[model samples]
Target: MIEKVKGILAGLAFRLIALLTLGQISPILSACVIIERDGKILLIDRSDGLGYTIPGGIVHYSETVEQCVLREAREETGYDVLLTGFVGVYSSLKRDPRFRAVALAYQGQIVGGTEHGSGEGSTCWQAPGDVFGHMAFDCESMLKDYLSEHQRFS
Candidate 1:
């Protein structure tokens, strides 16, 4: 299954990251967007078995965070979204278990494209209140901050 493959790949990736970093606090910069439609938010049922994660991923060296957000949103969720507002930056040490990742969160709305899932996972829409415990990483925290209408730096 794809999930099993992801799990195996994730294990390898995690170990490789840890070894390369040598246990240093080398945080990765990434961007994500909360794309809303009809009062529901887009969520990815990640194939890595890490539960649901918002559509996002590590920023490439060639792109800005804003560009990365747009690219990642389209790649993961198969929807083109326009950034409406910024959610906040999430940089907690525990934000991700595989590696330290700083999330540059933003609010967005669907602008184009069809619905589909990438190698990341399938896409689903859910109410903010309905996605509490099923979320992975610091995604739940990110959503809470966004819903509360406040900027967060955790």
Candidate 2:
């Protein structure tokens, strides 16, 4: 309800701005946080039938990538997380269906807050293997890369 309204408003605003710029906008920049606890990872089922994905969203004009990831995590999953490290950047043009988007992926630890679902989806914690082959967007690749890197250090 509220999320849908926000999305509609944002779409209108973007369209208006695009008209002003003659539709010369670049790919959107977003951030996603990979929160891990006890060998499990947090995922959200994006009610749109897009399946599970890392908790994340577009980085607002006034916010940095770090701030975006933390804010998105809290908003979507009801968790307060502290970023532990950056995983990597995902910028494939085909990664998103609506538009080209570049996502900054980060690794974080849940420091506080209870888990809950947002208008966008329900939240759950799953083992990395369970999530690996069943994520939406390019999240599977991102998760695998992050896990592989972490395993090397562990």
Candidate 3:
């Protein structure tokens, strides 16, 4: 149909623009959370020159979101996590440094491993709103949405 063709073209055009501007199509699959316990959330400080951010990273090829979160948690926080569900998907050009990324933010709970910062930075626990003090980017907007849509958070 003509409408279908137009939709396909529109999607193609968007992809082409993103690839051209960001250098490459960085298919990043990341996740984060507004982990709250006793009215506090967990956060991290990424000294990778990218600044502090909530704990997460790229999802490996063939890995599911739950698997990615568990792996990333271990790599960054020295812990394994059990994913409850997705907070939401965040794919924005201005949020990250390079390519536009599709981050599958999930709600997870820590299960095991010692609390030691790994990879590119340090980790910490803070109030959900207070996280902005050390946040690397504007992911707080997404986090805020997750908080507001608690019913649909999963």
Best prediction by TM-score: 1
Per-residue alpha-carbon lDDT of candidate 1 for residues 33-139, written as tens digits (9 for 90 to 100):
99777888899988877788899888999999999999999898888899999999898878877666788899999899998998888999999888899899899
Give the runs in model 1 whose Cα sits over 4 Å from its true position.
Answer: 1-25
Q: Residue 61: error of model 1 in Å?
A: 1.4
- What is the overall TM-score of model 2 with all chains considered together? 0.82
Computed on alpha carbons, the lDDT of every model, listed in order, comes to 0.85, 0.83, 0.65
Which segments of model 2 are wrong by more than 4 Å? Answer: 1-23, 150-154
lDDT of 2 by residue, 1-154 (tens): 5654665677677667778989888768998988887888899977766678999999999999899999999999999999998888788868865555788888889999999998889999899877666788898888887888742111
lDDT-superior candidate, 1 or 2? 1
Provide TM-scores for the models: 0.86, 0.82, 0.72
| Tens digits of lDDT, candidate 3, 24-70 | 55455566655555766666676554545667776778897777777
